[model samples]
Target: MSTTTPGARIEVRGLTKRFGGFTAVDDLSFDVEPGRITGFLGPNGAGKTTTLRMVLGLVRATAGDATIGGVRYVDLPDPLRTVGAALEATNFHPGRSGRDHLRVLADAASVPTRRVDELLELTGIPAAARKRAGQYSMGMRQRLGLAAALLGDPHVLVLDEPTNGLDPEGIRWLRGFLRRLSAEGKTILVSSHLLREVEQTVDDVVIIANGRLVKAGTMADIKGSPGAVVRTSDRAALAGALRVADVTSIPGEDDTLIADTTDLRLVGDVALRAGLPVYGLEPKRADLEALFFQLTEGTNRNETAATAAPPEGDAVTAQEGANP
Candidate 1:
């Protein structure tokens, strides 16, 4: 059978979740397009997990709705086949073998038994599939959770911190695996703090802070244009020229200057007119880590407070034994 399944769009409309006086998610809104991988990002306790829980119907929202293909997760005809989720790697019965764990889930979801072995091999865990989950390392457990998520060949995937226990090689493998699933038209929303890895993996991003929407867009659009990095023998002259052109610049190591404007020609012309000796000039795009910090810096007050005393309902507990 062809693996290319149709994907569904995920829409969150004015979603809000409050636990007593503290708000976990505040009027957040974003869409995860079909056939694309969207990175759901934020710092620790920034409501990312809470939002995903609300989306998966594991937690109730105070107001608004989260939908997959315009239908709430609770109303899906077959949630297992429609949306596969692995919120955490530890959601397993410690006594059960890894293979048996997936088999139990597949049976509950009415998935074929052969597909369990298929996923075990596909996730590169067949060698240890018979080992008890209690004996599996964190990385091994992550692979097993992923295998469980794919048991029904779901059209949409929601993964939270999927790379937590992976090594470099496993992380690289997961990047390729997620890309392949996207190529097969599965809508994916991955929540992770690994900004560098997410940058290389996702096509779009939805960033939140302090339980509120901060930024959301395609990677290129949000990163915008590349800034100009220039090195000149005459630092003072270059700085003055940049000022005349209304462009701002910051000093870099080894006396290099990083200009804030995307227009290379403008910087070049100003420097040329000023008769500054230019050593090097190049465009530099802001990495995801820098951008994430810039966007979420001061908006994490609630996140900070939650670290000390989280509200009663703020903790993300798996309500049912089955994966949402």
Candidate 2:
């Protein structure tokens, strides 16, 4: 393995991309810290791929910039040595054997030939190393792609939809591998549409929609905003009491009240003062999937609005058509 530092911070500032008149990414900004897995999450067509491409210097941004360790990808002295990227599973030449494909990359990067075999084994595809990439299964191809990414023993890893074709076991293995890498101080930025998988794997998240940032923070910081669910006799009284105490309570299922604070004792005390018997109080953790949906819903709405808007030069044409 290379003896370079294991992690580097990634910074995206006002990163924007436009395709003709349609904006694909709009001033999106977020930070991916070192020594942790940061999930780059968005629904389909939310510009997650475009943003990643911009970060990797694969796609030029119209308005902003992204950098790793304060250096743009193109400006890196030795890019592959600093950043390893696996954007797609089928990126390898189809005719080449998986081992040969890695060897080619290793040769180009000046990495030792034995490192190719080591990566094949590390990614758990040594048995199929001799198979043509065209004949490899999707899962196997993913493994090979990951092997190629790790060939340089880079400090930073950027992957897009890496779990797309993996079986449950493969996904589980990947989760563990990423965590172990993070523990070793590698900076990891993995993009996924799979919220459940990301929720389990990532330490922090940057959620975007309509090419704009929706939310960004540690998992705890995001989930910490939600409060507790309290069940009490006389739900209406409890609500009134909580309101008096300047704590808001929303009515929940099964005659329970959801308070805006996680403090169970405070909620119980308010209920006691209201002469309402507290039956139960359970912490209501915010569901990451639910929050993801909530944030992206506006993106869909904005997309619709943008799509429906008349082009700048078509205002007269639209008026003429409307009159007809």
Candidate 3:
């Protein structure tokens, strides 16, 4: 079932956020196309939540703009009916029942009460709908938060760590659910730390480091072609020979060298010409987890945050939504 408006394009241009002297997000830019699920990924304290907050108009940006359908979030006539966002799953009244929590939000958003029930069932939390929110497990709380996001039936969804507390089965169910929504022409942008899960679920990825955009593209485009790992007794000689053949090689486990090309015949010929004893040669596929670490290796902000504390305002911007 397509939404009334299908889905709107989400554009973030030069989105920057700063607190005091610390720059949380610097000149970030990306787009979430309609009918696709985009994964917003980064290391800890990489300003992901801050960016999302700015996009939702919860936190103002120091520079640039985040827009949906070419209009800023604050300017949307019916914000909830256009974009549904759940930045934090724990933002609920402790004493309120699970069902009541959604009902309350729905009422405030002018949504029909029946929509709440439908979302409750849709998110698979109806069995515990009457239980107090405080008594629910993290997984249940995640489900409740998802149900709340869908209560408006918006064409766009912005979820930060949406699968945070889900079990394997729950995660699988959510994968299918999101795919169905995308098939119905909804726009989805998910911020998550689970690289493997995001790799499987999202149609595209927007990876950042040190509050700057590093990569944004389809999975295949980013991963490129599979390279080969060659183990040899004389790595230096083999590397030199491969370099002469216009192939680059990097150090790998043991005495193995990782060649940047998938042409095994060329690698073998070069090594043989150099008289290097080859032990093992195999294809090395760069998975999402590997590529994520490779791209963000030295850009971790947590390492710095651990030793030095930022100013009061900076601290809040850096630590907000940092919970795992």
Candidate 4:
């Protein structure tokens, strides 16, 4: 669903940011509505970070502008109280305890001190509230950073690759945390090039490639365009009958059909008439990874196909959807 909050609408009107001579965000324009999680996605060098910086006013836009509720981020009254951003956990001070860190930020922003413990406890870091930031684990540090962002009870959240480094459990926790925040009428714009990671977590997605906006819409809207997937009881029978289907699935145990058919009822009717018993009918929706590759697949985007760094290697790129 498109994010729809009464306030905190983030509009990027042709925001262009240049790094030296290169345009990082090339004529980029999109709206990040409030009250939903907007997954900011792209390849490594596709300019996700640069685009976020423009929206936050951390980097000057060489062309257009990004506004938070009709005003720039810096223009907001008590910016931190209105917008909560966590670009990196490492941005915190090492010597301070998690509680102290939040306290300091509250003091600086003139927010109530009572919010410090509440946020620490809310993020499940109450045990480590007194622990120094330098001693915290990656997960703990992330939680601490999140607590800091929530301290002001902000309306909009801007996070850059929030799940950058962590174990599987940590990733899961962060996903739920972000969703809960969005559910509470907070607009969340999380930046990450890893399409697969953000696919299940976000309500909407904005994909950029080669510093240009490629797609921006709800996760459902983007994946819906890719088509539909349906599963039934007869795999081989369905596959044989759907020889001309846009997408079909591999055979699993026990003769179950998994085909990327847009219409399930239609497929079932055809299968029933063809004498194939139907057991299960499910749709395997296209995720962010599949949709992302389709958008940036054949195009050259300055960065090579290396799996380690900038651009679409593996950090945020996956190759699939060629099967039938």
lDDT, each prediction? 0.87, 0.83, 0.85, 0.73
Stretches of candidate 3 off by over 4 Å are 1-5, 226-284, 306-324
Superposition TM-score, candidate 4 onto the true structure = 0.77
Query: What TM-score, computed on C-alpha atoms, does each candidate reach?
Result: 0.85, 0.82, 0.79, 0.77
Encode model 3's per-residue lDDT on 79-157: one tens digit a residue.
7778888778788998999999988888887888989888888899899999999999988988888888777788899
Worst 10 residues of 4 by lDDT: 315-324
Q: Where does model 1 exceed 4 Å of error?
A: 233-275, 306-322
Question: Residue 260 of candidate 2: its Cα lDDT?
Answer: 91
Clashes of 4: 1
Per-residue lDDT of 151 in model 1: 85
By lDDT, the candidates rank as 1, 3, 2, 4
